[model samples]
Each structure stands twice: as C-alpha cells, then as structure tokens.
Target chain A: MQRAKVVGTLWLSSAIEDIRGFKILILKDLSSSKGGYFLAVDTVQAGVGDEVFTVSGSAARQSEATKNSVSDTAIVAIIDRVNEENI
Target chain B: MQRAKVVGTLWLSSAIEDIRGFKILILKDLSSSKGGYFLAVDTVQAGVGDEVFTVSGSAARQSEATKNSVSDTAIVAIIDRVNEENI
Candidate 1:
C-alpha cells in the first residue's frame, strides 16, 4: 500500500464499459517526493486533501466498491495519521 | 495506451503470489517529457531499446499471455514505426 492525497474529481461523459458508473478521483502521490498525481476509483469516502492509502493492479478490483471492476487503482482506506517513529 | 522504451529487465527473488513466473521489465515512459520509469510485464518478445506501447490497469490482464494474471501494466505490442504525421 502507498499513501496519497485526493486532489480532485473526474467526470467522464463516456468511459470504458468496465469502469462506468464510478466516481473517479485524482490523487497526488504522497509516497514520492515529486508530488505526482494519478487517477483512481474512490472506494472510500475520500475528499480533496484527505490522506488515503491505495491498492494498485488487480488488487484495486478486490475492493467491495470496485469488485469485478476494471480499475487500475483504488483508494481503499483513509489515514488519520502516520507515526514516523515506526520506520 | 502510451509509448515507452524498454530500458532493462528485473529479476525478483521474492514477489507476490499473482506474478510468480513473469519477467518484469523496466521501461522509460516516452509519453511524458519528464520520462518517468516504471515496471511492466513483457507480453511481446521485446528487448532493450525497443519502442513499445503498453496497457495499464486491469486491461493489462486482458492479453492472452497475461489473462487471469494480476499485472498492473503490460507491454502489449512493439512499435515498428511511428507515423508522426498521422497521429
């Protein structure tokens, strides 16, 4: 799992059959120093600036909200804090 | 789909259950000027310096060789030529 922050929402008038009817989220990759962003399906109730952890690959399809879906990535959990001491 | 160049190969002594026997490739993302590097499963017979196009997300699993697999990315085809004028 990796950490990210929700940055925006994406609404597509047309989308692939496997990913229809989903609320797509724009996430800023927090695990990287470059602060890059990518899109993922919102499995949890995440909003802009909310810190969340995500699953990539077919693991994204394992979430209940995205089960059997064709998502490349999914926001699975929201994080309250990170304990830096835990290494 | 996106353009990339094969840079190197990755051999993992330990890997997750879903991708046990596949050879992972290191690719330079040519779609972006920043040229980010990422890993992908090589579906085609690709080599270092070969220009290729890849499928990302669950779609990566749609290839015949990768069907029922759990890859996040896969090199689906090698580019023979680029008609810059057409696209």
Candidate 2:
C-alpha cells in the first residue's frame, strides 16, 4: 500500500464494463519525490483532498471493494493519521 | 497488470515471514517513459531480462502462486509476444 492524496475525480464516458459504478480518482503519491500521480478506483468513498492508502496491480481486483473489477489501482483505506516515527 | 522487464533480483536477509521462499525481483515498466522500477515477487520463475506481466496490490497476495504471502507485487506471467494492433 502507498500513501496518497485524492486530487480529483475521473469521469469516463465509456470504460470497461467491469468497472461500472466505481468512482475513478486521481491520486498524488505522498512519498515520492517525483510527485507521481495515477488513476485509481475508490472503494472507501474517498473525497478530493482526503489522505488515502491505495493498492495497485492485481491486488486491486481482489479487494472486497473492487472484486471482479478490472481495476489495477484501488483506494483501500482512508488514513486518519500518520506517525512517521512508528513506521 | 503491467508489462515490465525483470532487471534483477532482490536478496532480502530479513523480510516478513509470509513472503519467505518467494524470489523478489526488480522490474522496470516497459510502457512508462520515466523508466520506473519496483520490487515484485516471482511466481512464474521469471529470470533476469525476461519480459513478464506483474500483478500489484492485494491481488498480488491472492494468486495461487503467492496465496497466503504478504507480497504486494507478484510476477504472474511471462510474455512471449505482444500484439499491439490487436489491443
């Protein structure tokens, strides 16, 4: 899992049928120096500016939230706080 | 899933117990212009310089090859060819 902030929503007029009804989000990586961003399916109903934990790859499809979906990226958790020292 | 080339192997002296016995690989994304790389567990026994398809996130843990493991990345298939026009 990676820490990220939801930046915006992606409204696709046409997408794979397996992804119907899932909210697609644009996420900015919080830990990368390159400021990488990627598209992810929101399962926790994360909002713009919310801190989230995203799972990428096939694991995205195995989550209870995104099961059977063809998503490669999925927001799996909403972070309440981050204590760097504990990590 | 993403297409990547296996560049190297990761030898971890200490890692989570759930990931034991899995070969950790360094993969370079073939489609990304940034030439990004990440660690992945190998299930298909891909070798260095092999072209492989990787599954990421929680789905990585659900594959028959990596089930019950704590890996976040797993190489699921070795690609023999890519038919771009058919895609």
Candidate 3:
C-alpha cells in the first residue's frame, strides 16, 4: 500500500448500478520518486487532507460499493502515521 | 511503488475536457496480503496481462495525456519481474 492524501471528491450522476452506494475520492499517490496522485474508491471514510492507504483492482472489487462496480482503485485504510526506517 | 496487474481497460466517451486523449485501464494491486486491484492510468504501454508500476495524483497529472486532465492514477512503468527478499 502507498501513502496518499485525499485531494478531492468525484460526483457521478450515473455510474454502474451496483456502485450506487459507494463514494469515490481523488487521491495523491505519495510513493513515487516525484510523488503522484489518482482517483480512488474510498472505503475507510477518509476526508480531504487525510492521509490514507489505497488498494486497487480485485481488492477494490471486494468492497460493497464495487460488488458489481467496474472500479480499479479503493481506499482500504486511513493512515494515522507512518514510520520510515533507514534503508 | 506497488506491483499491479492490468486487468482491463476503460473506454470513456465524455470525460473532463483535458483528459480527452488519455487512455484509462483497470489495474489490480498486487501488494495486499489478500491481493487487490483498481483502475489506473497507463503510461507504459502495458497490456492486460502485464505487471506494471503505477503513479497517482499530481504525479499522474504530470503526464502529457493528463496535462489538463482531472485524473488520479497513471501507470509509470512496466515490470519484467520482482524478487522478494526474506524479511
């Protein structure tokens, strides 16, 4: 998983029928050399500015919002803190 | 970066005006203990079965296709293999 910040939210009027109850958020991927971001499905009730953990693909499909959704990204956890040990 | 599998592709007819020329693909996150997947932008020309490196957020927005896009995910590289060192 990667550390990310919730940057924004997406409002979809018409999406797949199965994903009607799910919420989607735009996330910034913080694991890259230059850092990056992307839109991801939110499952942990994260808000803008909160750091989060994201899982993608079949794992995303495992969430109720994506039970039948065509989603590829999902927030699996809200990060309280991270510890980086020297390599 | 996390290892992921390209599971599928997304064909959008109308998206943010800035994202018109970008291609979107669905991805599976391979890092979780249970393993998961999600949708990610493709920058490395990866195929459905290819394992790739993905960068999200502002980093995703850094690509030419997403120059003005409202995208949250972007594939950064293609992986030929991975070696798991014992922890």
Candidate 4:
C-alpha cells in the first residue's frame, strides 16, 4: 500500500461493465511528485484532501466493494496520522 | 494494469501467511525512469528480462494463482507487443 491524497472525483457516463457501481477518485501519490496522479476506486468513503492508503493491482479488485470489478486501484483505508519514527 | 520488466527474484525465509506459495519477483516500471523497483507476485511464469503487465490492489489477490493471498501486486500477463499508434 502507498499513501496518497484524494484530489478529485471522476465522472464517467459510460464505464466498463465490472466497474459500474464504484466511485472513482483521483489520487496523488504523497511520496512522489513526478508521477502525477492516478484514478482509484473509493471504498473507504474518502473525500478530497483526505489522506488515504491505497492498494493497487489485483489486490484492488478484491475489495468487498469492488469484487468482480475491473478496478486496478482502490482506497483501502483513511489514514488518521503518521509517525515517521515508528515507521 | 501497467507494463514492467521483471528484474530479479526474492528469496524469503519466512513470508506472510497468505503469500506462501507465490513467487515474488522484482519489477521495474517500463513507463517511468525514476520510480525504482517494487515487488510483485508472479502468476504468469515471467522470467527476468521479460516484459509483463501487472495488476495491483485487490484485483491481484483475485487471480486464480493468488486467490486468498495477501499480495498487493501480481503479474497478470506477458506482453507480446505494443502498438502505440493504435492506442
């Protein structure tokens, strides 16, 4: 998992059949500034500016909310705080 | 999914319970020059130097090879070619 910030929501009039019910959000990787942003399915009810931990790849499709979906990324948790010393 | 090159193999004396039978390989993103490398479970029998497409998040765990595993990344397919003009 990686830490990211929710930047915005994506609205698609037509989407792949497996991803019909999920909310897709834009996420910026907090660890890198050069990679730009990527879209992720929101499962934790995160909002813009919220710090979240995301799972990518097939692990994203395993989320209960995205099961059987074609999502390649998903917000798995909303981070409350981080302490670098303990990491 | 993203395109990446298999770099090397990882030998773990002990691993997380959910990922025991999976073979973990190092992957470098083919699309980026600065992101370094990350670990991915191999499902498609990829070898070092092979270009492969990988799935992340829960979708990775849903693969027949990684079902019930805790992998956050997985190699889903081996790429044969790319036609950028048609993309």
Query: Which predicted model would earn the best lDDT?
Result: 1
List residue ranges in candidate 4 displaced over 4 A. A1-70, A73-87, B85-87
Instruction: Give a tens-digit lDDT track for model 4, residues B10-66.
Output: 988778787787889999886444656888988777899987666676666665567
Question: Who is ahead in lDDT, 3 or 4?
Answer: 4
> Candidate 3, which CAPRI tier?
incorrect
Across A1-87, the per-residue lDDT of candidate 3 in tens digits comes to 355789999898867676676788988876544466688877667799987656554445554445477777777555544433221
**TM value for model 3:** 0.48
Error of 3 at B59 (Å): 1.7
* lDDT scores in order: 0.72, 0.71, 0.64, 0.72
Off by over 4 Å in 3: A1-87
- DockQ-based CAPRI category assigned to the predicted complex of candidate 1: incorrect
Would you give me the overall lDDT of model 1? 0.72
All candidates: TM-score: 0.54, 0.53, 0.48, 0.53
Over B1-87, each residue of candidate 2 has an lDDT whose tens digit, in order, gives 889888765443222244446676667778677776666779987888889998776768877878865467778999999877745
Q: How would the candidate models be sorted by lDDT, starting from the highest?
A: 1, 4, 2, 3
Write the residue-wise lDDT of candidate 1 on B1-87 in tens digits: 356899999998767778889989999986545889999998777889988766597667765677767887887666554422100
Interface RMSD of 3: 15.1
* C-alpha RMSD of each candidate structure in angstroms: 9.5, 10.0, 14.8, 9.3
Q: After superposition, how far is residue A50 of candidate 3 from its true place, in Å?
A: 29
